[model samples]
Target chain A: MFVQATESSTGVSHDVARLGRLVRGLPETALVVDAITGLGTTDLQPDEWGLDIVIGGSQKALMVPPGLAFLGVSEKAWKLIERSKLPRFYFNLARERKAQSKSEVSFTPATTLVVALHTALEYIRSMGREKLIANAAMLAEATRAAASALGLGLFAESSPANALTAVSAPAGMDSGAIIKELRARFGAIVANGQGSMKGKIFRIAHLGYYDAPDMFALIASLEIVLTKLGHTCELGAGVARAQEVYLGFVEQEAQAAQAGRP
Target chain B: MFVQATESSTGVSHDVARLGRLVRGLPETALVVDAITGLGTTDLQPDEWGLDIVIGGSQKALMVPPGLAFLGVSEKAWKLIERSKLPRFYFNLARERKAQSKSEVSFTPATTLVVALHTALEYIRSMGREKLIANAAMLAEATRAAASALGLGLFAESSPANALTAVSAPAGMDSGAIIKELRARFGAIVANGQGSMKGKIFRIAHLGYYDAPDMFALIASLEIVLTKLGHTCELGAGVARAQEVYLGFVEQEAQAAQAGRP
Candidate 1:
């Protein structure tokens, strides 16, 4: 099995299309993709990418409580599962697939969470999936722009994630201090780096249920937090950059509408 | 140096009092306890037990979302943290302690979750901590009794947890089937076993935001699911046993009140 856990620790998504080409060489290999944080952040084509098994969680892009998980299985994966020797029960994909085929679940489904996920899915559908993906990408672009405006460095040197922006902390200043000030002073909660990267970087997420106004508020708060932490920068520089990103999108939409007018 | 992660995967709580005795021999060692699921499930005496570091999450007994985590530090633990060489940043307990000393958090705190936790804490206080622990214990006892009445076996043989009851599936029957039927037929969501124990057992949680009526309803549903799954049992057997447990508690409380009358 070729297991590819997409979406990095810093929120960067892997190039699955490139990975798919490699998988084509190993025709018999089962490709398992962990799309936990990738689903709403970017456009994913499992079939096109030859992704055999794609896993997702409800908490991230689905905007629900943590309990339910989703899986996308291909025909090749189903055949592989049939011949697999792994002793499985609760997480048995074949069992779930059989039940799903009958419009049911193999185990006790998280009913409340399923309802919440359904509602979130409906909202995403209404907004259009392509538009939702674009919204995340645009917000991520805005965040990167804002961070640059604040004279901060990007943590992900290559293939930065659309779900969140990881920014390097200023020299000799702990990112934890910035995170602390944001919450204490303005009640804004941002994530600091995980594991070994802690204190070196901070992350701001713009994926799923986030919009331009939320980005504006976050950037504004960030600017205040950075200043409070003794980082010398002009007030509203980050917010202004983010605002420009939003305005650019609005302008594009307006021009598109005008071009299509009867 | 010496860390102890308390709380079991099966929801059982360890005997901290006994563990504390062992820790006393190693004076310089830090006693780190994962009290995430143990806090509301059982009586935890951190200070008295000389527990150096006690960790907790907002979910489980706290009845909040799964973003916020809390830590209780001791003076002895602080000394260890000061000299610790382990590369630390986001989970730096020292930084959190320092920030908390000033009524702040070291990272972007989950603001909404913190607020919800605060409300939950207030409710816990109103109900009284001892009473809360007793409630979980009572509910767990009732569940065990009900399961026994239904001819089901307990998974935890020696140290059963007050948070949840793990029950073994009947011979030749998959617990997953029971879990599925419960959800599909009655909208009740119970958890099946994890890993190796899957298909053999199921778990029913009695911790956090649960009452006697909830237990009654759960048992009633379990009876229906078991019957539908070809398990031979008298209808309402489990529920009747649960009701008896509740009635016993009421009788005891009435007797206590009568004895207290001057």
Candidate 2:
């Protein structure tokens, strides 16, 4: 079974843990998760969930430029791949494993990008991966609060990803208008909905390389854009709510640390 | 048929042009040239030589860091590839072409390295690719002249590449000693013979990002290392010869430019 941990295009976060449980006890079955945008920002444990394969991309929560993909394949999947006689060339794991064993890459790699990723990964390690995930979660919580205060509906309200929040545009107003206004006024480039949701929703991304100040600016801009687009919006309403959420998170973190330290 | 325009591993250059002519009448045959290190440093015209495919690397004549491999596939080669039943995932040309037509990469790309390559290519284009190749040829000629003056025999005397010159070690002496001494004394990182010829020869690279001054320094350092290692070499003999070559090249370039002005 192949499933995306979160669908970025549709702003849908799938119940991956539930899916993992459903596929258990099927010895021949392998659960493959596309956690390209979910890893480092969400709760995903391939080992704990018995996932056979997990695919990741560098450009998302890794805070690196795109161009690299990472794969986690379980021992059982390796056995299955070996037995299957599908003619594989470039992505052949066995060939890559053989080269890696000798301390070499199977192909010419983007050397500078790898160096940059190494540096980014070192910083991530210094902060601890869990801490980074917790940061994303905090930011996501703040953004959700801000969106609700602004009277905007969540696109993925049932299951929102910590990496980003997708909010529907005000009734009768295209999201592209707000997206353009944010870019022009505040130099904030938000993503308009893709596919069928195009122009209907705008995404506020707070994944890697984002902080509380950025979220405040985004929410403040969103309020201004909504009012400018003729929607009845109270300026600072969203920003104040977002600030409250941020304040609450900081206090909670401090209390948790205080309790744990004692 | 597959052949290297210049074999960097063995310091040998093949007669690629002649081979291209040999396969002309055979419609089913496609000549593929591995010009990884040879492309910018050597004189090669794939189209003129009826080559169906040419492979290049970023770290070679482009002066960019390694991790990128480029391919020039002719329409004829594409037809053959389409007809062949090969299971290629990552290097799938058709898939890449489709994505590229929509102005996107087929996979997450090392964004920074591509940007670096773009800058290097812009510089290459501004100077003219032919000029860059000529510069490499001049440097290679000077290195060859310097090696001859130093009483060193050429490893690929019959077909030496313009990218680098490989010199045979003195009789009964390992090339590793000369290589180590060069690095230790002058900070020159010359390459030792690879594969079966290891320790038999030392190579002086004059490919991309190299100039006449670098050549002079390398030859002077070689003279010092050879003398220190008990070889009876005149200290300034190679340097003087290289200076003459550099002077000759400058005079020829000035004369040609002067003639073209009229």
Candidate 3:
């Protein structure tokens, strides 16, 4: 069973472990999984969770062009593959496994993309996984506080995601129009709502390679958009709230490090 | 019938009328047409070709980080909403369309990627579509000729793609190992055979913002790889062949324009 990562990007730490227990509780001897959604953006360890298969695409938290999808499979899943019969050609996991063992791919892999992926991964490694997750979560907290200050409702109110922030559009204002204006005017591009919420909300990403300043720029543009749409809210209020959240996170991080005395 | 493009840097032009005829011949109406393999790299007018939808991702020819996928649907596709049922929440087309009309995305679109894509698209527009395609094709031709001169076999014997060139691995060397060494020692990343052809062949990409000189550099790397692998081939043959192809392409383009004169 695939657990869609709607807005739980802080780290799959809790959900993934819960999923592992649930899957293992089933009567089946083995379980196969596709952990593509929040794999890179969140902290994930397939081995730790006993996940059978963990798939990842080169984009997203990996910070590279698409074209490459990486998968990690367990021994139990490997055995089932011999008996399973599904028409597989391009996305053949078996062949990919064999090739990847020798540091290769199963087809004409996207070379340039792989190069960029390599570079991006190197960056991730240098930053450290724990720090990356912390950074993403901090950004999310800051953005959420800022959105609240602007009187914009958080779309995913219950379980906020660190990958991005989704805020409801003001009454009668088209989310698409705001997005278009951002692109056309300020050259800032944000996301709109999906599925049932289309045109009702917009999203701001603060995932990879982003910081407090990035959030400020985004909030500034958002203020312009909200003002243009006649949404009454105090200017700079949102940014100030976000700044406070950011400062709190930094302080907490410093305290944690200090408490871990040698 | 989504055809994969060989031109890694750009999209190719397919005969729209013929494709329309092929789709019309199908027994049932395809609900969600996934043009995943070719849309971004090739120039396709789904609306004109009787296609219900056209899909693309931010990477490939779009020249952006890969997390975003794009879909363009026709009027007929929109009509499928009443009867169609696919378990889709994130990649829902209708909701995205509604939001897109206002120039927004249906979900938390990758901000960094969106920014990069916008930059890439504008860059393409500046280069002009015709010039971009021509440049991509020319680079592919140069790569193929150079590889051929070095006694390397082309992987795709028929309808070889202009996106990238796939070459057979030499008799006694592992293409994957060769790839690793090239990347590790020289900082040049070439691709190894994917899927069924793993370790049997290698691929070289000549797309997006690359030129003949870049292709020349790749060919030189190939020579070094071959020599180190104990494969006997003329030292400068590949480079010479690449130069000839580049020169020939420029001449042909000039001649074609001249012939178009009234």
Candidate 4:
């Protein structure tokens, strides 16, 4: 089992492709579980990645209450579940699958949270999964470019997730302090470094339920935070970079469409 | 380890005494962890229950996202922590204690969910913990009496949790069907039987973020459901019974206060 999380907060597309190659190479690995990582900020198609199992939670890119976990199982993984012996009393994939056939849950499901998750998924499906993924990727690309223009580096040196763009604080500035200031002064909820990089980096999420304007506002806020924290960053540089990335994405997609014309 | 979740959602003063006896009986029971089953919907004092570790999650009575888990540990539990070696990497109680000392979280905490949990807890604290529990118990008591009057039987039979009333559906009717109808027709969400009782019983929750009106509303909805499904039930009977329970609870509390007056 290979567990790969879709973490493209800044729309790094390379990681998904890299994962595809890794999955193709592993023969003994019965399942490849994408922990909503392939979607990046944009919701990626399961078929597109050729993944066996895609595990998604309600809170992340789904933008709903956190109770339900959605798993899209491939035929291969489904067959292997019969032999997979992980001690799962509550999160049993087989039980959930059986219940799902009748539009029900195996356990006494969290009624209210499941309802919320259902509603959120419905909205995402209605928006068209392709479009949602594209929007997320575009948002991530824009955010990353904006952060780069501010002279701050990204946490993931390569192959970043499109859901959030982890930005490094300039030399001598504390990323933790910047996160606190952003929350205290602006009331904007952004993420910080996880695991070993707690004070070394900060994260800006551009996932579900966000737009271009939100990104622009966030960039502007970051610029202020950088300046107040004694970091020398051009006032409009971040926003301008974000705009450039957005325009570039639109142009590339348009060109691709024109090229596909028979 | 004998885990005894508090029986009632709004556990009565008598329930606390019962729990005390249960806790005192166990030997080598280094920890008395209180899941406080109905604590969210009912009133509780950690001190009153003689709880060594009180555990709570954000979904039930604390109307918030589900990622946050709160634990209030006693000195005895803290001392035992020096000996616990149960391969717990994610939920390390000792790490959490250290973080709490500095008013922080041990791991990469679910920042958004914690914010939501804080808001919900604040709402409860503002309403007054005693009043909140009393209100939940009153509503639950009413729900139970109303359910019984309507020819329904309690599922937990001998000891029903006050946070939610679980009722066994009539022999011919599917409990799942009743649960589905309550949500589909009345836009009300009720719980279904958990574990072994799936499809056999339905639950009506009347805990946090609820009042007498809410409980009565569910009772009235249940009556409609019973009538439509061929059970003999008069509309308003359940609601009236629930109302009587609420009034009785208030009167009893008033009498107890008067008797203990200085």
- lDDT winner: 2
lDDT of 3 by residue, A1-262 (tens): 5554424332222366667666765544444454444554566666677666676766566766545667777776777675568656765778778888999666655556677878988898998877777777888888889888998888777767677778888888888988988887788988777667779888887667777898898898888878887888888999999889988988998899899987
- Distance from true position, residue A27, model 3, in Å? 5.6
lDDT of 1: 0.80
| Candidate 1 lDDT by residue in tens digits, A1-262 | 4543435458666787777667757757877878777788777888887888888787777677666678888887888788888756666888787888889776545455677789999998998887777788899899999989999999875778787888888888899999998889888888888879899899887778888988899889888888888898789999899889989988997898899998
For model 2, residues A1-262, the per-residue Cα lDDT tens digits are 9998876775567888888787777777888899887888888988778778899888888998877787898887888777777776677888888888999788777667788889999999998898888888888888889888889999988889888888999899999999999999999988999769999999988777888899888898889889999988789999999889889988988999899995
> Given the true complex, what DockQ would model 4 score?
0.17
- Comparing to the true complex, what docking class would candidate 2 get? medium
Q: How close is candidate 3 to the true structure, as a TM-score?
A: 0.58
Would you list the C-alpha lDDT of every candidate in the order shown? 0.80, 0.86, 0.71, 0.72
Per-residue lDDT of model 1, residues B49-130, tens digit only = 8888888777778777665667888888888788998866776877877788889776544355667889999999998887
Question: Could you tell me the lDDT of residue B22 within candidate 4?
Answer: 67
TM-score winner: 2
Write candidate 3's Cα lDDT for B49-162 as tens digits. 676666666655556655566676666667765357865666567777788888976655445566777888899889776676677678878887888889888777565655
* Clash tally for model 4: 21
Off by over 4 Å in 2: A1-3, A14-33, A52-55, A71-104, A151-153, A170-174, A194-197, B18-30, B77-85, B151-153, B170-174, B193-197
